[model samples]
Target: MCYNATTSATAFTISVLCSIYLIYSGNKTHNNVDIFAGIATFMIGLMQLLEYVLWKNQDCNWINKYASMSIPVVLYLQIIVFHIANKYLYNATSPTYDNVYIIMNILFAIYVICLLVWLSDQKLCSKPSANSCRLVWAPFEKLLNYKYGSYNVGWVLLLLGFLFYIQFGIPLNGLFYLQRSFSVHKHNYPIRNIFPYITIIAALVYTIVTDGKRMSDTFGSMWCFLCVSYGIVSIMHI
Candidate 1:
């Protein structure tokens, strides 16, 4: 998750290779679901590539504005891909869960729209390090502190908790239920069953290990990187 042009380019390359392999294997095996997963993988790679562009052209205002705008859309598309894949792979057609997905997408849409609107007046990009032009929510920091009070640890924790729950918790919860309901042999589905927990743990580790100052500078970028990078794990399902 290092925010540098080199690392971003490398991630994009790896994701591209992995996506090609996954798609080719899916085609040969006639597994349409795998194709969807491959597409998701490619989306993740696309995001990293966008980051690379932003890193390289940090001084270009138009490039930064459009590229920054594209990031949230790409991130949201990943969730849509997951929803489609879940339906095809697990036959997850439960109306309740479908409604949950719909609501989640709506909420995510509002969140993205609000963020983009809020950052419209300010530069949506940040140069956290000499070589890094990372997307961040720095513009919101002042507003958040002003609204919630400065040095409000509780508010930060609550905000992060909600973000994580929306980004990971709900989808994983739905997946967990779907897997259990669909699997023919429950005992054999260890990896799928525990994957959500693993993801949550990894995210927690990320939050704990990232430098606080760096986290403030690149909180949005860090979370997006974590989500996209971990998306490679979809290969396991494929």
Candidate 2:
């Protein structure tokens, strides 16, 4: 099955509870990163629940398509926001921080527009079928489409954002702050430093695997699982 009801239900429940707790406590803490992370987590759980429901109905194209693609944008936002929040926690504000946040927001907006256009142009079907179902193309073909060059622009922005995130957010801010927050023996600083790189590597490997077989359900599931699991872990650290 494309979406297992049992598993999705369980995920949905846990995600909802997490969302409530994170939002409530995040407000108390006055942390934007945790707030956004909580929002992203809530969305993830909502998306999983929607996927489960839509899988049975099969006629809800717009909602399903948009929900699926919009996830990455929020996921990226959560990470960037986390970086800013972490900096606030440490009182390590930089002059360029606002500029970085603005740039990232612009890029995120561009990506969202591009993805929405791509999804809206899709050839949707009421029922899932080999010829009608476009699951594989959703991530590969649709996302990569260069019509109007928005896709290219989106990718450029995303790549630049990734570099900035790693440069300012992950290696310097994230690693240092996390190390300070947790004891040396309790937290593996080196591993934490490498986590972002690991995620990038995993994305590259998944892209290669998907390129070989776009329609492979197993590969897609594995990719989604890794990404979602990693996202959850990242949020927990916030």
Candidate 3:
């Protein structure tokens, strides 16, 4: 008998759709973290959808238990972490270039490390329990090398994107209608012609080189989607 979890399905569908719509609209407009951040958001939603639907249909209790209980929560938390990271980069008004981004990323790394330790220490929740599904993080991180080296490099690029958006994009495009008296053309933005493009391309190329084929394929797809969408849209509006 097929499980009748329409509520879960509906929730996932709504989230994914909202994410897609936001990305599309945000891309066509200008640099919006709503679009950049939507990648992780939609991935979380997709995982949730798979947990509910795939788990039930496959008749795999373990898969359901693991995915529904642990995976979605972990994915959700990661998405939130990235969201905060992006926001921090966006609102950065500091004069020191790269310092703020480096500091922001350092804090983020510390947070993730602490979170992993706390979760694994078994004080927060029982391992493999309904709420104890965060165990996937430890081994996964090790195997995927999602820390220090490659991951650190990736964080730097993301930080660049956020800072670029805040300083250049917000001023030129006017997100919250903070219009300036000094008129400047859309294409006149400093990083518009170079930094963003180079940053994204370099990130994907590095990931492909260092992280092997799997990560290359994975983040490469995301890189292509984001960079291409932003390029096309930004160019069109220019």
lDDT leader: 1
Quick one: how many clashes does candidate 1 have?
A: 0
Residue 52 Cα positional deviation in candidate 2, in Å, after optimal superposition: 3.2
Native-referenced Cα lDDT, model 2 = 0.50
With candidate 1 superimposed using the best TM-score fit, by how many Å does residue 169's alpha carbon deviate from the native?
A: 8.2
What's the lDDT for all of these models? 0.58, 0.50, 0.40
Highest-scoring model, TM-score: 1
Misplaced by over 4 Å in model 1 are: 130-174, 177-200, 209-238
| Predicted candidate 1 versus true structure: per-residue lDDT over 19-120, tens digit per residue | 787688877876654564466567657767777777777774777766766765666666666666656655656687678667877877777677567656
Sorted by lDDT (best first), the order is 1, 2, 3
lDDT of 1 at 222: 46
Error of 1 at 16 (Å): 1.6
For each candidate, give its TM-score against the true structure: 0.69, 0.54, 0.33
The clash tally of candidate 3 reads: 0
Question: What ordering of candidates by TM-score runs from best to worst?
Answer: 1, 2, 3
Model 3, 1-238: lDDT tens per residue? 0122454455466556656765687678654544543454455355345434443543434454344335324433443444343444245233453465455555545544554453343322112212222122222323233356445444454344345433423222223211221122232333433334455556557666775434323332343243233334333333
RMSD of 1: 4.8
Model 3 stretches with alpha carbons more than 4 Å out: 1-4, 31-33, 36-47, 50-60, 76-238
TM-score of predicted model 2?
A: 0.54
